[model samples]
Target chain A: MSLLQTIFEETFKISYEEANQDLAMQDVANWDSLTHMDLISAIEDKLAIRLSSDEIADMTSFDAIKRIVNEHQ
Target chain B: MHNIIVFGTGKISESCSYYLTKKYNIFAYVCDNDFVTDEPFLGKPVIAIDSVAKSYPPNEYAAFVAVGYQELNTLRESKVEQLTTLGYQLVSYYPQHTPINGPIGHNSMIMDDAVIQPCVTVGNNVLVWGGAMVGHHSVLQDHCWISGGCAIGGGATIGERTFVGINATLGNAITVGRDAIIGSGAICNKCIAEGSVLITAETPTYRLNSHQFIRFSSEFNSRN
Candidate 1:
């Protein structure tokens, strides 16, 4: 699995195939604000990198998330 | 006119009993199912929860379930339902110190430094620990533990017994399942399962200040 896919799957506890942009951050009813913090922490932990607040805000889509990961490296 | 009874022997319950002592007319403290004590808690007898109904007579007084965790919350919820069914009113407490702007259930403990925002629905026996913030429209189910320094965003739903670790942050509109363990400093953006444990990254050891002993003298201590 790709890095983005792995991060999403592990952080969200969903299958890699299940994580898509359409299942957007507020689109999922169960994905509350607290869980968003958890997701950020999880991603940050896994990647060993810090995310800028602007970058964190901009990462609302799968493609955006992919770009963020790419930029980290 | 209101008779209060506290359940459980935990520190939280003790603190609740102590805090409420001055504000309410506490009659007894019922620890668990069978333990009862006559020691005056704020000048009232500390009795066990089970014996309160029998000793005090349900018609005359009300009770507060002071137990912790989801199991006890569930039990107290059922008991409250039963008591209400039997025509006894369950007392609801919202400490003025905690900023509660929404529907907080009976038997919940809103400790010192808790900031409960608008539209939050906190269920019974919930522990909003010190320095915890419940954002707008959040729904924390019965027995949830919003640990000290934890920040929950708006419209979040925390399942029963979900223990949010210290300084853990959750985004808005998230749902964490029952018994979920969010590790300290974790930033959550996704829904967690009933037993899932989500941990955050620790700062590298090299960057952390590991120095334990700083050079100090008695003269330095005495000086300005």
Candidate 2:
């Protein structure tokens, strides 16, 4: 499994296969304001990266998160 | 005196850099990678942030992120995180004559004449501009900016990155959520949800223009 899948599955309690760039907050079962923060923390920790406050707020889609991760890398 | 590296060249930075001189020896002003130049700021050398650690090692010199309230202070938050990860210790600034009666976090600044009442908990990267009054037991969360002359009532809880604008007033025990904006001169007395914007109505002039009003009001009042 990809690192993004692992992180998303771990943070949102979703299956690894369900984690994709097309996925968003509404598509996920348990995504909320609190869990979104958890997802951000997980992404930052696993990627060894830091996201700006705007970045954290704007990362609604899995695609956006992947984009940020790629850009930072 | 402690050696300090100030990050930013804008007005807020200039003011804090001046006030910081009271406690710290000025080292230099650092710039973002995009704003690199040989020009000096406030008569101090401006160094590129990318190479600041090489000449002014973080082990010896402390850092202050003097960025202003752009992007609801998220910009400053980003800079603080960047600088901290680079191994520099962040420092808070309380200008001369500013009264701080509570616990404030790192890289925050309380400007001149601002009064922090007892037991107020101020979080990281907060900016309280000049003449602001934060009431007792209020909790100001991280990355918030309280503009000049703002009066926050006692026991109010301000969430992260919330902006209380100039001369705004908040009633006692109000809870303002994250990413909220209480505009200038607004009087807020109730709880606000996240991402709320409270803008006061613009004051409209009289039907007559200023000159016409001045000419007509001489009998009643000339202050128009």
Candidate 3:
């Protein structure tokens, strides 16, 4: 699985099939503000890239996160 | 009076500067080279972090990193490391009104109205915002951020870099692991694993109209 997919699956405790670019915060049951921070931390830990609060706030969807990871990489 | 330089010009830095001005002489505000600004901060000169060492030597002046908890507190941690590497004495903020019975680590900011009970040990670079209560004998590890109005019970051990949101409550003797995130209004009773995230369930709102449920005094008088 892709890095983004793996992050979504582990952080959200969702299945790989449920993790997709179209998946948004509103679509997930456990994607609260706390989980959002956890996801950000997880991404940072896995990718070794630090994200500012603005970047974290802008990550509303999987596609946005992918874009952010790409930009940082 | 001891001269101290405050890093950053954000709200946290401003508050820390204000807190330090009472006891120490405010030397200057230091920011990154990329932060473009020529304005004076609270009537003090704003200089770049790299340039601070030249004018204000580490032996003569101290430093306080007033950055907030961002990126799971890694940003604040990095600033702490940078300030320490510069050989500046890192100062902590503990308001006179806030009772600290035990040792609090350097570079931590315990804001006003925070009640830290006896035997509470707070680690370095921690930020316990206003009105937060750290119960007796609780231990907060390095780089933790406890938001305003949080109630951490006695004997609780909060791990490194954990972020406890506003109004969260942790029960007595509970151990929260490293890099954990406790959401606002969450009541944690059990131990939280490392890198875990705990969020409270959203409160369900009632949809019934209040006026429809009220019993009028006139109706009671008519019945009498």
Task: State in Å the error of residue B124, model 3.
Answer: 0.9
**Residue B166 miss distance in model 1 (angstroms):** 2.1
Interface RMSD of 2: 25.8
lDDT of 3 by residue, B85-127 (tens): 9999998878775555566799888877688888788899899
The per-prediction i-RMS, to one decimal, reads: 20.5, 25.8, 21.6
Candidate 1 per-residue C-alpha lDDT over B54-136 given as tens digits, one digit per residue, 9 for 90 to 100: 88777877766665545524565565565566455667666665545465776677775688887788886577876888898
Tens-place lDDT digits, model 1, residues A3-66: 6677677667776567754355544444443455566687788888897765665565566677
| Candidate 3 chain B: worst-modelled 10 consecutive residues by lDDT | B212-221
Question: Can you give the lDDT of residue B65 in candidate 2?
Answer: 91
Clash pairs (backbone) in predicted model 2:
none
Alpha-carbon lDDT of model 2: 0.83
Local accuracy of candidate 3 as per-residue lDDT tens digits, A1-73? 8887999999999987888656776677777656876888899999899876556767777888899889998
Q: Taking chain A of candidate 1, what TM-score results?
A: 0.74
Query: Comparing 1 and 2 by TM-score, which wins?
Result: 2
Output the better candidate (1/3) by lDDT: 3
lDDT (0-100) at residue A16 of candidate 3? 79
